[model samples]
Target: MSERQRYAVLNLPAVPEVSAIKIVFNRRSAIIITFTTPEKEHIQG
Candidate 1:
């Protein structure tokens, strides 16, 4: 017999036209980050 996979859908709110987003990840005492602009451009650091 095989198990079924479940998935969930997330509905995110609309971002402001002039807003920017940032994401950060930490691994083994190192930090990686990403920046996003309102125009949907990704900046890596």
Candidate 2:
């Protein structure tokens, strides 16, 4: 039997615009990434 190596890859798709990016630490102290897009503004208003 032969052993083969496995790998995992993560990629972010192209974004037209990244208005804002925020990094926060929650109660658990885990890093969280937040993205604010143009679409969000229309919904918020």
Candidate 3:
């Protein structure tokens, strides 16, 4: 299976529309998601 397929299995977007998503797994077994907006797009945080 490819990386894209792994994301699909988790029901996550492989390519986000407006921003980029960063997935982090901490030592505490917690999932952290970070959204980073591009300079070209206007995203309301």
Candidate 4:
């Protein structure tokens, strides 16, 4: 098996756009979580 290449904007097939996004974290905590429909997955799939 081959290793997957990381994401690169210059390697993308189309103009990336985001319709929704969210960033979750506690004000007293340092942890953070992000959730979004990545443009790459959205179109490629």
Candidate 5:
């Protein structure tokens, strides 16, 4: 197995009314990434 890289976490309460969240990753350089709650999961039969 291979090792995974680490990431930083940030929280924002500007828009508390909404049920959305954002995540940012600072790797190699400064970059921003966004993600929402109740993430998707895959199932295989």
Candidate 6:
């Protein structure tokens, strides 16, 4: 999937609007989430 779509799937609003995200993993489970702001309009981080 495209990076934008990938991020969108996770509720992220473009990488530029993102400050940071955390990855949580334990044994066989993992997830990524971050706070997003729509201040930027860039496609690439």
What is the TM-score of each predicted model, taking all chains together? 0.32, 0.44, 0.44, 0.25, 0.25, 0.31
Give a tens-digit lDDT track for model 6, residues 4-45: 865665674455656655444456644444344466443232
- Local distance difference test, each candidate: 0.44, 0.49, 0.59, 0.37, 0.39, 0.51
Tens digits of per-residue lDDT, candidate 5, 1-45, equal 112323223333354443554444466545454534344332111
Report the CA-based lDDT of candidate 2 relative to the real structure: 0.49
Clashes in model 4: which pairs? none
**lDDT tens digits, residues 1-45, model 4?**
123432432243532364443333477744342324554433221
Superposition-based RMSD of candidate 4 using all C-alpha atoms, in angstroms: 10.5
Alpha carbon lDDT of residue 32, candidate 5? 55
CA lDDT for candidate 4: 0.37
Ranking by lDDT: 3, 6, 2, 1, 5, 4
Local error of candidate 6 at residue 24 (angstroms): 0.3
Error of 4 at 4 (Å): 37
> By lDDT, is 1 or 6 better?
6
Reference-based lDDT, residue 36, model 5: 45
Of models 1 and 3, which has the larger lDDT? 3
List model 1 lDDT by residue over 1-45, tens digit each.
112211111123444652553445466634344546666577666
Worst 10-residue lDDT window for candidate 3 reads 36-45
lDDT of model 6 at residue 19? 69
Better of 3 and 4 by lDDT: 3
| Model 1 misplaced regions, further than 4 Å | 1-18
Best by lDDT: 3
lDDT of 5 at 31: 45
